[model samples]
Target: MGGPDSLTKDTAHDVASHRIASVEGENGGGKEDAKDNALQALSTFLRDDMEACNREIVARMQSPVPLIPQLGAHLVAAGGKRLRPLLTLAAARLCGYEPSPERQRHVGLAACVEFIHTATLLHDDVVDESTLRRGLASANAVFGNKASVLVGDFLFARSFQLMTADGSLKVMAILSAASATIAEGEVLQMATQNDLSTPIERYLEVIHGKTAALFAAACRVGAVVAGRPEAEEAALEAYGTNLGMAFQLVDDALDYAADQQVLGKTVGDDMREGKITLPVLAAYQAGNEEDRAFWLRVIETGEQHDEDLPHALDLIARTGAIQTTLERAQSYARAAMQALDIFPESEIRQLLMDAASYTVSRVN
Candidate 1:
């Protein structure tokens, strides 16, 4: 896998540590506490059900081939917050779906959402040639790409099986469309990857495909399982779509603005990979001829050097690229919160709203 230059492991580690210290000092208390509290509230609300979802994940990952289970488990056990699955469960409960042997099927459906997300991550690491995931070596980095890809396929297959087992054609249709959309989004991102001229519209399209589509699908499934009316279904989907957009925008900005530890990845990984995220697009479009030339050389031509990162960061900061990106994220977060208004007031509704704000707070 001959990719463009990337930071050495040691360099990224040191840079991340320094960024964490700086963020800790600058961000003192407020939003950080809110973010943690919101996530904790959601997690506490769904703890028992999430445990059941985990058990379902483990049961479904079984294959006669031990390597398949091992690789799948490795990725699954990695430190993701399981936000998508949580959305499914919470959305269902918010719709007043009562717990029963029948209602418990939501757990399996939530597990299916996790499998889809995990499969995508596995394939994404292969596509990106990524070495680290969730602060540890990626499965592809340790087990080899062939194993990762095949195991990812297995997971995708497993998810479809789980979807079918739930016996809801509505659920099946929503998740299947999302799966295809996610693939299309990955390919779209590939097409736009190194092109500095990639427009903001195209960038948003890519993220909607890659990130938000599944989020919408996940939440929509919850309402479906609850036998909620189509209006409620649309509301949850809207909530998820906006939340997903906000989440990705924050993520794109954090890749440039966050400390390595806080971000759980290298600061300039997107730039190094020539991925044209919002911040890069913002700075490039805002710059004069000289800045455009710099972007052309580094992003388009992949001629980045050590000094180029600082220069890029300087350009982004001076152009208020991160600030503008985060502002867009906040707008989406607000929209996400607004989407929940049609639902009755409940602790779950407030937590979901808080969850939207928490998604963008990393960049705040």
Candidate 2:
């Protein structure tokens, strides 16, 4: 890898090209900086390694079958934060791994992490019937669902190939377990869908499997690759897990938010799909008798009409569900920050801290 000077310049350009619009005069720019630094700062510090990882991702996504690479490239071009692989790379660096042949191995592993995430996204769009992803047409929307599913299987196979090349039982075990958890979580979410009776603990279990499992695995693999001690590995896993919990909780709340631009999709999509998120659960749990009847008619019976969304929003507001959800997210972010106590203070650690804050900052 190049020195810090070259890395800083390259990564800043990458950040500027992909960053969200900065919030003007918001919290004296503290909030804006926190959001920007979520990915930008980490990319700056890991520029060279990330570039290598990006190259591997692109190269591996190719196939002679035109449909496979075509859909894969379409998703690659669609802008996402690419945060999963970034976490993998950043964790490696935070644990004192530097640019070397051994460190270079992490590049492919990071790409493997990205492949796993992308594969899940493809499958999720088909399952959720989601039309949009990152403000662009989703793979399942553009490609047929059958094609998307097959291509997703291809990506998963590719990820497993990368894992095998690493030849570390620990890495293999972690990634494989994460993959199983993600599948299990999706099934559990589907099973719980539209049932307002779903408990908060069950909801937490679903997200932990679907979202936080991979986040923990991503960070753990970084430590495993670096041959870090078990204590440091566990800390990174804790940090990633809590950060992921915060991220998903905010995402669930945003489904019913009024601001569509920030979400890049229609508000109340979860409600429309009859997905039982935290805010919905909160409102339903606290509702009056009439409110309960209305919710049962809409959610359980799937009898929702166009006017139902506004009433749902009203109920959510009366219950202060969004605020309660945000508070829960903040608690997780604090826990994620505490997980970093074992590491000595560094710019990388600070960026990670800010990233956790940024996860919950979407509500602002």
* Best lDDT among the predictions, by candidate number: 1
Query: Candidate 1, residues 158-202: lDDT per residue as tens digits?
Result: 999999899988899999999999999999999998898788999
lDDT of 1 at 49: 75
Error of 1 at 157 (Å): 0.3
lDDT of each: 0.84, 0.81
Model 1's alpha-carbon lDDT is 0.84
Kindly report which residue stretches of model 1 are placed more than 4 angstroms away from their true locations once superposed: 1-35
Enumerate residue pairs that collide in model 1.
Answer: none
